[model samples]
Target: MMRARTRKLIGTVALIIFLGVYAWVAAVIGAGRISLAPAWAQFAYFLAAGLLWVLPAGLLIRWMQRAD
Candidate 1:
């Protein structure tokens, strides 16, 4: 059981890293289209990016809980 827990934790960490980098890249690509966008637009863009990350993270959390 302990081993399973450790594996889940590692998997969750990897998921976070993967999702974070992917989201960042996606955001950067989106940002490139708006060269003159305002500061508020950038802030809103990141907020949207974070919200998108949450859906996958919820799945990761459920998987980690079941790993035990």
Candidate 2:
């Protein structure tokens, strides 16, 4: 099993990479399709996209903080 420090370091890097890719994808999709959508639809899409990363990140963080 990995040590706590190793887990945190790995998790931190993973989270950074995950968020960067997620944001890029979200921006691309938002610009390509969501921009043409109605205001409400755009709002909904952006809102959901904005918050959707938390779940996976939260789980990763929990894992990172888990006892070794």
User: Which residues of candidate 1, in runs, are more than 4 Å off?
Assistant: 1-3, 37-44
lDDT of 1 by residue, 1-68 (tens): 46666868786787979887977787686669644678888777767866777777777777667734
User: How many pairs in model 2 have backbone atoms within 3 A of each other, for residues 3 or more apart or on separate chains, i.e. clashes?
Assistant: 0
Model 2: per-residue Cα lDDT at residue 24: 99
lDDT of 2 by residue, 1-62 (tens): 89999999999999999999999999999999899999999999999999999999999999
| Pairs that clash in candidate 2 | none
Per-residue lDDT for 13 in model 1?
Answer: 84
Residue 63 lDDT (model 2): 97
Q: Worst 10-residue stretch by lDDT in candidate 1?
A: 59-68
State in Å the error of residue 60, model 1. 0.7
What is the lDDT of every predicted structure here? 0.74, 0.97
- Please list the Cα RMSD from the true structure of every candidate, rounded to 1 decimal place: 3.6, 0.5
Q: How many clashes does the backbone of model 1 have?
A: 0
Cα lDDT for residue 24, candidate 1: 75
